[model samples]
Target: MKDWPGPVSTCWNHWIAVPTGDQAGVMEVLSLSSPTPITFAEAQEVIDADAHGNPDDRHHLSRVFVTPEVDSWTLVIGAWCNPCDSERHEDVLRLCKALSARYGGAQAYYYGEQGDGSAWLVAEHGSVVRRYAATGELDDELLTLGDPLPQEQARRLELGLPADGDPQAASSEQIEEWTWAAFHLAPEIAAAYGVSPFTLTREAKVRGTGVLALTPDAASHGI
Candidate 1:
């Protein structure tokens, strides 16, 4: 086992994590095109370049990068690869299902600091196991799937949320509190499910290599 120098902030906003070292398999599942192996340094360069108007049609509309193998997990990063950006739980479940079909399991997370929102979804063997999201801008549940994860259940209990979310029985302040709990849970939820990319520290074991790839959606358009 070896320690990573540190984690970069680019992945803090959105990322999909599949528990596997097979970067090719993850890229294949994503339908990514023209993958070129690159170090984390080069991966950061690709992201930075795309941000400053790299003017390369090769990436089409977005750039997606895969992280070097981190222990048993490989992370995929891109704004287009998120539920927070879409504000759609279905997108998270769909992508997780696709990745899980090939990788056995997948976890997707999103955190929008400006929006003060966060979302997380877990899928396994082609089925979504759980999903949750909150932006604090809606009264209705933005999204909730399956059941609460153990850590979530514990958090809810600690915060006094009942096992059954009966809004009818709760007061306005209580509802607001619960809604607040929903935001900013990506890190905790991710920690419980798998690796939390942004917080990865020296203790994490990394191997193989990462890469930059053109997204399939963009590449298919002949860019």
Candidate 2:
């Protein structure tokens, strides 16, 4: 109801997108529990508290926030989006498969707030079709999987690089040039798929509050 979270409630550090308005089904795939009716402001508080840390609790980071149906997609937000700090790409791929298996399609996106690192993943029927990420550190890329999306290929061609060329093998000059294009593609590609997480309020709203839920790992550990 009350004007769904949005463009300004934005600063989305990480999130997962699935093409369905069914939070219940999305929750099932994510293995979430205890759907507390939370406003966008309240959801932000949970994310903040997790980031702030708790003195007496060791598993404070396991909590995740879910968004109301923005356009036709439900966004599951938390550390899960970054796959536990992106230490393993397999975790990201697995999450994509899990969500896509039931949702028809799924996308995982992480737009690094503290750095230029950004990543986007696409999967259908439990298989990854495209993945791209640049850590913005000493290397040009931290991970790359499957093939480039149509938009990615076109962008690369526009930049004078081969549409299917390996960004990992780019020169320092090509790296600087193309990396700029890659990091910005996260939101652009999201817009193409369905909802750009940042501009949520711009889309039509159906009347439900977002929620704070226990992630699968947290629930398994009884945290």
Candidate 3:
């Protein structure tokens, strides 16, 4: 059997982290003049330096690996999780919008579903492209902007299989199968997004597109 690569958190999803301080937090993903992107060590320092005792409120950070066209840095935050709360889901959707507005892209991948109902979000150039259920089904109508950009379409076709075809028609089994295949190809997808596959697989790459593509072990430490 080909063993899957890494921790469940980083291994299976893409993510980003930002401060919870509203505008201040918003600036982290975007700045007026395009400030220098934060390094992985800098992001990690922030995470390690966080004094918050609560796991959910803790600051977890990861370097986004992406092409230069997509400005701004991305990190995966460790916010509190409230299962079955539509309000919580809305809160995240709002954040996704904010990231899209300020920067050009952002995304979040919950470590696991647990009480939460879904796990992935794709936002770009100030709008949400799609949202997916925990089982990888793109069923939620919570935020559907209709017709993603050409770049978004290309990336979706490349990275998100099965679910991307017709999220509404995807079954749980199909979603699971896609997840398995996607995770196994995480390194290849990461490379397509710009980072080298070998570098990402070895955890040597620090930057990547926010949840667009990622190293399998990217979220392991912060989570």
Write one digit per residue (lDDT tens) for candidate 2, span 1-223.
4645664223436678888889898888767888888877777766656655652463544667888777677887776566325443577678779889888999887776555567888999989888777656543344667888988888888877778967566667875777787767777787888776566664466446688888766765568
Q: In model 2, what is the error at residue 97, expressed in angstroms?
A: 1.0
Residue 192, candidate 3: Cα error in Å is 5.4
Q: lDDT per residue, candidate 3, 144-206, as tens digits? A: 345543433454456444323465666676555555543243333223333321232323322
- Backbone collisions counted per model: 0, 0, 14
lDDT of 1: 0.70
Least well predicted 10-residue stretch by lDDT in candidate 1: 1-10
Candidate 3 TM-score, C-alpha based? 0.41
Candidate 1 lDDT, 4-98, residue by residue in tens: 43454442367789999888888877777787777665666566555445434545145677887887888987655675544335665687898
Q: TM-score for every candidate vs. truth?
A: 0.82, 0.83, 0.41
Q: Which RMSD does model 3 reach against the true structure?
A: 11.1
CA lDDT for candidate 2: 0.72
